[model samples]
Target: MHRHRGVAALAAAVVLWASFALTIRGIGASGLTPVDAAFLRFVTPVLLLAPWLPRALRAVRRERPGVVVALCLAGLPHFLLSALGGRLTTAALVGLLLPGSVPLFVAVILAVTRGERVRGRRLIALTAIVLGIAATAVLTTAGATTTGIGVLLAAGFVWAVYTIGLGRTRLDLISVVLVICTPAALVAAVLEVTGALPVNLTSAPVSHLALFVVLQGVGTGIFSTLSYGYAVRRLGSGIPAVIGAISPVLTTVLAVPLFGEPITAGVLVALALVVGGVITYNVKPRDRAGSALAGPPPAAGHRPHVRGLQPHLTTGVVEHPAAAGQLHLQ
Candidate 1:
């Protein structure tokens, strides 16, 4: 894949992810217990990727023993809290707030722990994202369901922790996800088998259990994990973080149709600010002059290379020559 195509693929992944809020709402609309719904969502992914578990586990043992264990511990709160939040809140709010919260928290954490200072464009971008989120939340407050608003706030905090955890740990994508998910699956299964999960879907007329299979299994499991890995691999985590800025706007816009919610000027303005900030943050000064003269360009993809203590993994379908300074996976 070329650079442009890789970017398009990344965008498509976000769009696919954007669909998840709607799906989750549909499941929750059916009135399933949060635990039951969460159980299905968490376990489906493990089963879908179970075939690859051996390879993922081997990678864990080789490169990230401590990280592998930490994943389980870190993911417990991330999944459980978010799952509960989703069930208690509107899908639209939970989805939008979580992404909006990630960048701000990631910046703070990186600055404190890694000594990575937020500078120049990044600082501005971070500021704009924070302002946009505040604006949207403030404007939407009167209209937001109180329950949804409360749950979304909690969800945002949980997501912030997860985002920081990712930066803190050095682990392969598959291995880390597997480690996190395996334990989550065990806990959920325990709940279900112990009769803590209500199974009244037969009378409820909506089968959220079935819906969880698609939402977590296909959407969160395959699409989310692949998109995340590929995005970070090909473009670096910064690019994805920039692109994720639009997630809040995407969820809000999509919700207009899915939930019959009204779209106001506040949402559009917030989207504009967020998009502008992201562009400013990611664009290099020299690219301005080159961009005008450029015609069609090649797609961008993974060009793995040595970076710090970890071996960089290629993110997308793009491949590069050795001379380009990218390391080929052995």
Candidate 2:
């Protein structure tokens, strides 16, 4: 039953994740800058989850300062990079490159830092992901720029760091949400007040504002975070991760009609390779002893050891906020 719930939650979160890519790309029509959209994204969660701030702060104090900083990097900075990259490139590339590159970056980070070996299927998965990203950047003529590809790839690496840092902390769902959103909201507010980041919140069309507030704020900010985390807890990171790999494809398909983005042969090839690689990476092989060795489903919030990259789940369903930013590829 719990696994069923997790699958449902994860499916919903993937849809929201795709919507994030769409909305970020659609911001120009709404008269909101990337910064403005990010402000709404960060601030909404901070205000709605304000009651958990104190506890989250206390937890932060107990954590290594680096982990907290990593969490913050994954919030606003990641969002801005993604938003900018989406603007410079097609929404299809934004969806494909951002999340698709995460596991590859995670594997590289782990291999370099922790000496975790990537052999067997893991190696093949990473290879496929690399080829996919390369093909998209080099072959796709679907309005993608070199600068945009670089920015989204950078965003992927940052989220990879956040995923690693999240595994090192013990903050629960609400606390994780607060810890990431609070500082981001404050920074955005400062930028807005100082005239560094433009604000169209007051004059933007009501319908546009409503769209962003609901999709970016409520859906991506709150619901995706909670649902993805819940899915990880109940299903163990592997299943949800594999299913979540579909976001890029979904986003690409939606972009066709919504943004009139063209789907070329290069885009389709890139999607096939990246999605296949992501699913391959997330799948855990059974041991020689098979189901007997596989033991029962872990209790809620228990982290199961799945080979390759998996997002670290904290207590409760609120792990990392990357899900909200469209990189739920974690």
Candidate 3:
């Protein structure tokens, strides 16, 4: 694994997400709607990745193309649904439910589909994420809605699956973005055409549109998506979730200055927990003092494959296919 590259990817993704949250918060503070913002989300990516469309289309059509294309749907509706749900629900609920539970969703998917067990430190790190996200939610001055809860949860699930798919397969990032964003832009175009989601550039102040293109379009849509894919490509599936879980903290921190949001004791504590969890999650077995030894693996499926992670472990020594080295475990 290109460990450094993964770390860089994870870092870039986390920064983009944090910026995304901050932008969303700013939108919430204004009378401006996110419909146009959502529209821009899809369109920006389409334009940015236009050059790579042909190749990405080829990738999407190849080797489980349907699955890849289906996975592509994850990001398309997230912004729109989340925007609609926000109108129906509280900001706090939206924040807590979506980013907070995404990790659990990913963990379940990996365990059930990939048969990757969440044992030891992974579990501990996950628990910390849960706790941190919960704390952040409690500190948030937002509202609630029965319907909004469902929408946000669905959003969380979509993103989790999206993250998992990125790590699960070896696909070119640009191609995946092309496959995903093209249809997403089309969806937004449909909404605009139907007048279901009105987009009036003239009606909206010029300043708002500028912000939308800069933050929502370029930052969140292009940079965020590419960075996350890169991060997942590097960090694998686990720490990306950890990094994502911490985005709320970044939101809160940035929101304090940008959105005139306050930082409460709960916010401080939540930040601590989130930061701690990220640290813990990134701590590899080699980082710990004689890190708690992992046992052996089962006879099948447990053999160390260098390219990706495997499951059904007995916890003995597993040979790393790429490293061609032994993972010394308990």
Q: What is the C-alpha lDDT of each candidate?
A: 0.51, 0.71, 0.52
Off by over 4 Å in 3: 1-14, 28-32, 84-100, 133-151, 224-247, 287-330
The candidates, ranked best first by lDDT, are 2, 3, 1
Per-candidate TM equals 0.71, 0.88, 0.70
Model number with the top lDDT:
2
User: Candidates sorted by TM-score, descending order?
Assistant: 2, 1, 3
Per-residue C-alpha lDDT of model 1 across residues 108-143, encoded as one tens digit per residue:
655786777777876897788677667666766554
Q: Cα lDDT for residue 53, model 2?
A: 82
Global local distance difference test of model 1: 0.51
Residue 190's C-alpha lDDT in candidate 3? 76
lDDT at residue 116 of model 2 (Cα atoms): 80
Residue-by-residue lDDT tens digits, candidate 3, 111-167: 897687778886886788678766654554545455555676676666665554544
Q: Which residue pairs come into collision in candidate 1?
A: 2-299, 2-300, 3-298, 3-299, 3-300, 4-299, 4-300, 230-315, 233-315, 234-315
Q: Give the worst 10-residue stretch by lDDT in candidate 2.
A: 312-321
Count: clashes, candidate 1: 10
